[model samples]
Target: MEKLLEILNDIQPDADYETCTTLIDDEVLDSFAILSIVGELEEAFDIEITPVDIVPENFNSAQALWDMVQRLQEA
Candidate 1:
């Protein structure tokens, strides 16, 4: 979670990641930011975020992203 926060902060320092629940819907993260986050997440978590996994529900918030990462790890 700390590492996720770090990456998110690097991408968008102004947004409150800890409590944000509408990252995508609120337009908090644009295409470039999302792509950057995808790269960072893939490298940091040692996971591959394929096109199928790039959904708004999966990137809604920090907890959602963490949940997706954990699910992918388990798989």
Candidate 2:
């Protein structure tokens, strides 16, 4: 989770990823940022993020992203 936070912070240092749940809804993360995060997550976690996993639900908050990563790792 800390590593996920690091990734989020590196990509966008303005928002509080720890508590923010409307990252996508609030436009804190645009398309470019989302793509950057996807690439970073893929390389860091050694997991593939398919098009199906690119929904706003999975990218909304830090916890959601972590949950998705764990789920993919298990798969």
Candidate 3:
């Protein structure tokens, strides 16, 4: 969770990771931002983010991102 928050903060410093859930819904993260985040996540966590994993539920918040990372790492 902390690592996820770190990654998100690096991309959008103004984002409140704790309070935010739907980053896209809140307008905190757009499509481009999600791409940047995917890049960072791949590098930082050593996991490949597939197109199938690019759903809004997976990238909605810090918790969701963390969950996705865990699932990918397990895969």
Candidate 4:
């Protein structure tokens, strides 16, 4: 989770990722930011983020993203 926070912070340091749940819905993470995050998450977690997994619900919060990563890793 700390690693995830680091990756997220590197992408957008201003936003409070720990508490923000409406990241994509609120436009806190725009397309460009999402692109950055996807790249970072893939590289950091050594997991491939399939197109099917790139949805707002999976990316709306840090916990959601972490859960997705864990699922991908287990798979």
For candidate 1, the lDDT comes to: 0.93
Q: What is the clash tally of candidate 1?
A: 0
Model 2 CA deviation exceeding 4 Å by range:
none
- Candidate 1 per-residue lDDT, tens place, 1-75, comes to 899999999999999898999999999999999999999999999999999999999998999999988988888
Pitting candidate 3 against candidate 4, the one with the higher lDDT is 4
Question: In candidate 4, which residue pairs clash?
Answer: none
TM per candidate comes to 0.96, 0.98, 0.92, 0.96
Cα shift from native, residue 5, model 2 (Å): 0.4
- Candidate 1 off by > 4 Å: none
- The digit string of per-residue lDDT tens for model 2 on 24-60 reads 9999999999999999999999999999999999999
In angstroms, the error of model 4 at 21 is 0.6
Model 4 lDDT per residue over 1-75, tens place: 999999999898888997999999999988999989999999989999999999999999999999999999999
Best by lDDT: 2
Least well predicted 10-residue stretch by lDDT in candidate 4: 9-18
Lowest lDDT block of 10, candidate 1: 66-75
RMSD of each: 0.6, 0.5, 1.0, 0.6
Task: Tell me the whole-model lDDT of each prediction, alpha carbons only.
Answer: 0.93, 0.96, 0.89, 0.93
